[model samples]
Target chain A: METINYQNFRIEAENICVDYNGKVALYDANLRLKPGQICGLVGMNGAGKTTFFNALTGFVNISKGKIRINGESLRSAQKDQTIAYVPQNEGIDSQFPISVWDVVMMGRYGSMNIFRCPRESDVQAVKDAIERVDLTDHLSTPIGNLSGGQRKRTFLARAIAQRASILLLDEPFSGVDIRTEKLISELFIQFKKEGKTILLSTHDMIHVREFCDLVLLINKTVVAYGETSEVFTPENITTTFGGISPDFLFGPES
Target chain B: MELFSFLNLDTFITDPLTHDFMRKALLMSSLVAAVCGFLSSYLTLKGWALMGDAVSHSVMPGVVVAYALGLPFSLGAFIFGVGSVALIGFIKQKSRVKEDTVIGLVFTGFFALGIVLVSKIKSNIDLHSILFGSPLGISLSDVKQTIFISLLVVILLSIFRKDLMLYCFDPRHAKTVGINVFFLHYLLLTCLSLAAVVGLQSVGIILVVAMLITPGATAYLLTDKFDNMTVISVLSAIISSLIGIYVSFWLDLETGGSIVLAQTFIFLFAFLFAPRYGIFKLQKLFAGYK
Candidate 1:
């Protein structure tokens, strides 16, 4: 509950490669992120954005290189519960009878000893997370009953409840409304000020230019990585998405 | 009036209670319902309803082979049920066949083989009883075995209930939290196998799938909370089983079939009358407005 010291938290992945059934899905990739920064992972579909997130979370094997978080290996970070992840929202069953409160409480399960009951602090944290997402009214409602935007916020609340120094979110804004997008943007700013390093994948270049401190453009490999202004460009967008249609690249920033 | 006469206390309840075999049948059926009902919630939540059916049917070959080898039928059924799951996982992973198609193929193939083996071997294992449970014929040892297996299932379920719920609800999140997804996966399957084998005697293989699915699903319609769902499911199963055994006695019907129907009837009641999720409630509200 104390104020977090953000300076020492960093994510460093060097020469990470991933192969699925002998097919090279991701090539040598290097990434370095400092605490208190919101980094946007930009790529087209099948551009390995999800794969990169999976690698950082230790969900998939990185065949060729190492990833370290806060000077520890990715595996160590995972074991110590230093990293929290919000996976892509497609596969979750909406009809599942879990409540919003229960979903947020799940965040504590990672850090708590397996057999131990949640402490008062853990319960308070879950309550705080749900309130932050403005889902206090829907605390006991089945998650399936929530609107798409509310559901998205529920997952964000879960990640926040995790209290991890580093957060990895995959496509958090997809299918959300403008108000939800604004709420997420504000939350990211608050998280950054609190010294949490956050990396999120998005197809919206406008959002990246507006909110991200750093941008990493990747297409099965690291194409560019630097300050958002420098990394996000027409040429970089063209290279990542190909020349099929440059309208999304050239569209005015929203 | 004649239909209601079957419920006469002296003729139905007292007469059946006087017989030891009927009492055992009632107890065994209730145990099967309690165990299978509890598991049905997880199976339905995970969208593994067909997988439950697949595993139940796939155990046929294993049961037949176990009989031929003079081994315990439950052991054989458990092995084959787990093997079928692994095979389905393999085929789903290895080939282009989608999971449902693969499940259909594997369960049918295993079932056919079981049928062939049952015909070829000279054994005391009644094919009819194996297909449709013989409640009246269950021995004392069978009763003891069912009790043991049901207790084990209940204990294991309680110990791992939280982790298993997390696993079934959101597996990827469970993995990130360092919950061994692999362990939870196999553990649930093992429990399912055990439940299937135990229920196979009371409901037979075909109806065991229903026992594994109906109670949980019926409870699902009644409550949004999982803990409540479990309690409701167990209660429903026991109630239905008791009713089923009594109904079977009066009508001289298959005990397993009667139990399954009782559970189904309960499900229909829940489906129509449940407060928030019921069809009849919604219809009544609409009709009131009209």
Candidate 2:
């Protein structure tokens, strides 16, 4: 394997390929994301958006190629707690007996001792994260009792509390209320200003266009990736989604 | 009225403790119940109730083998309990069979092997006592073993409470935070096996599942916090053990059956009358509409 300098980018993936039991899920995918950029990962259902996110987070093994987070290998970066991943809500068991406070506190577990007893700093970080998400009123409430938007905010707050340089959010907009969407949009801008690299996968084109400075289109591999103005075009959408009506791209008036 | 006779204060509480065997039975059963109850919270949280049942049943063969070899029963039982879990995982991964089906298949097969072994051997190990338990017949060594295993489980669980809870709640998140989720998974399974071995000695194989499930399930209905759930579960189990031991002595019933039955009754009571999540409470909240 040839070595590439990763110092210029916060996240760099070079020709990464992933296969599941002999079937290719992602192939020859390459991406480089600098700090202070919000990248929207756009793809159709089962088109490998999630697969790419999983690869970036080291949740799934890449059969070939390399991934560097902040110029460090994935394992070392993970050890340093450099990445915070907020997965889709479908994977969580909401009926679990956990509180909003408890969920957010988990983000600080990486920094705590083996016993996981939270210190003063950890508690303050969790409180700040929850207040940022506007969930201070529901801190002690069981997660199961929260509404859909509030639940989404709870997980977002967890990612916030993690204090990682890279935030990977999978489908953050789905099943969330308009207020949650607005809050998340605002949070993304703030994160960008803080020089954090944010990559989020979403099916909502309007959200992608509104919140992301860069866009990545995938259909089993990287189809197009660049400035949202130049790459998230109808032609690229057609190429990535395979002949979808143009009206859906820009809404009914288009 | 006949049943109420056993509830007399002397027979129910005072006289039972006067006998040495009754006192030992109470101690042994209470210790076993406390640990099982504590672990039951995790088992229910992880949705591993069936897994508990599978491990408990699978340990039967190990107990039989231990008896045949004149070895400590817990060692053999622990081996079989963990072996069954591994076997189930293996079969589920290797074939198209669902995990529940694999669990059911493995446990039943292992249990049948144990029954066969017991039948073939001419040892003094009674199948009746093995199936339903003999709390009153517990030897001093059995008491020491139960205490040692329970303390080990409780200490280890307390130390890793947060990590194990995170692993049970969201394994993906646990991994992202650099937690060794694979090790936690095996650690939890090992604890479950140890709990099973202890339950096997006190409640026997058949009713041990109840000891390992009911306290936690009942507490789950009564509380919304894991810490409170654990405390409630342990207290309920301890109370039920005492009541069950007293009832068994006063009514001349099977000790293990009475203990499990007592736990079931508590679960039923909580299901009907719990403050927030009970069926009757919900019904009463809407009574004005009708």
Candidate 3:
């Protein structure tokens, strides 16, 4: 697979708003993403990164907003299975007594007719995902037994198996070992090369400074949106997290 | 002479009434086992113990309604059970109240209404069958009712097995994968209501809860996979059924009580001694290795 150049909008949000229990979570949040790029959403806790993702994916209702992918609405993308969302945490109960292979196989469900059973191609896709994520060894193991990093990798395997055109990831690097984070970062680069659009949220400065093509910093509002090098200035770092020295962005050692 | 008559083939075989009662009991018991056994796995997975209780108890009003309307009793139980489940789901999702609170609220209110209805029709109706079993009193008509509901339940389950599996395990993920969470949730509740309606006569309210729950919970301790858990649940239910009936026949005990007692034994077995996920298994592993 070859990377497509950034072109027309693959994902767009206009005046998106969401409210939970009468408390506004996200208000008139506007975002746009083009195909074949890796974008990072860097935000403080409760800065509405997840809410925006949920709204774009239709996990929550779109109130007072226009969201579309590839010139079609979010509702239309749902029918086309164009957006594949990987939540902050995987939803399968850890003790559910299911295999790693089975978890990955869940990706194929979107591609299958709901009324019919999953077919052999679905199984093969899952296998390919497992092999790609270097989880061939743990294919038979129950998901509960996996380490935190392995679990994240398994979720990546699910998205890969899904073969979705757009990927929505929420903090994939959280609580993972550096080595595991490195591997996931490499995989995202590979996904970009294959012409898939990725929108991920994170607070990890290293991943942001080195890899992302676009960066959006927020604390309940979009502070900066542009190339990572342009938006990730020393002043911007101190502004996003309160009281942090500009030198802390790279730190004394670096 | 009487003892010899009890032992004689001519006496035993020629008593048509006793033979009929025995056959009816076996058919009815198996039907109860078949439905309750399989349905319990879903109930356990969903953490709806109270909902199951509510469905069973709420159907009391439905039965009363049926008596009042002069319709078939099973139809009444089904309507009330299904309707109440929908109501519970609607309230929980649509309101600020927590789910258990909603279930308790709806079930208690519906059950109270049923009590009032039954009290109104008290003289003409004997609604003991709604609360407890008359297993020895199963009629041919009861068998017909059990068969129809069980068959419908089994067929619907098989058709939706994959969606239901995902729906139970990871509902948000299920939604991501194109399974409508609300639709499947209500569909499963509908199945539970149907099973609850049929299970009323043979297993009674309390025992039906025990049967649907204990077997699946027991199976959870034994297997770490969905397919195996379902299988183990059905197997445990069947074994309990056969032994419960045997124990009842041998000792002249209540059928529902004995079956639940047997299930409790398995629960105790899995609880105390099963491996890996079981308490005993964890203990054994802790003592022996990791």
Best candidate (score: DockQ): 2
What is the TM-score of candidate 1? 0.93
For candidate 2, the docking band is medium
TM-score ranking from best candidate downward: 2, 1, 3
Report DockQ per prediction, comma-separated.
Answer: 0.62, 0.68, 0.46
The model with the greatest lDDT is: 2
| Model 2 misplaced stretches (Cα beyond 4 Å) | A1-7, A19-23, A246-253, B1-5, B282-290
- Each prediction's total of clashing residue pairs, residues at least 3 apart in sequence or on different chains, is 0, 0, 1
Q: Candidate 3's chain A scores what TM-score?
A: 0.90
Decide which is better by TM-score, 1 or 3. Answer: 1
lDDT by residue (tens digit), candidate 1, B1-290: 87677677777777788899888888788888889888888888887899999999999999999888987778899999999999999988888778899999999999999999998896877999999988889977777778888899988888888889988898777777677888999989999999999888888999889888899899999988988998999999899889888988888888889989999999999999887799877656877888
Query: What is the fraction of true interface contacts found in candidate 3?
Result: 0.35
lDDT of 2 by residue, A1-254 (tens): 22333346989999999987568999999999988889999888889988898888787889999999878899888777789989788869998889999999999998899999899999999999999999999999999999888999999999899888889999999999999989988998899878888999988888888989899999999999999999988888888987786576557644
Question: For model 3, how does the per-residue alpha-carbon lDDT over A13-116 read when each residue is reduced to its tens digit?
Answer: 77778887566887776778887788899877888888777777777786677887888977677766677877665444677777888778877877787554
Q: Give TM per candidate.
A: 0.93, 0.93, 0.89
List the lowest-lDDT window of 10 residues for candidate 3 chain B.
Answer: B8-17
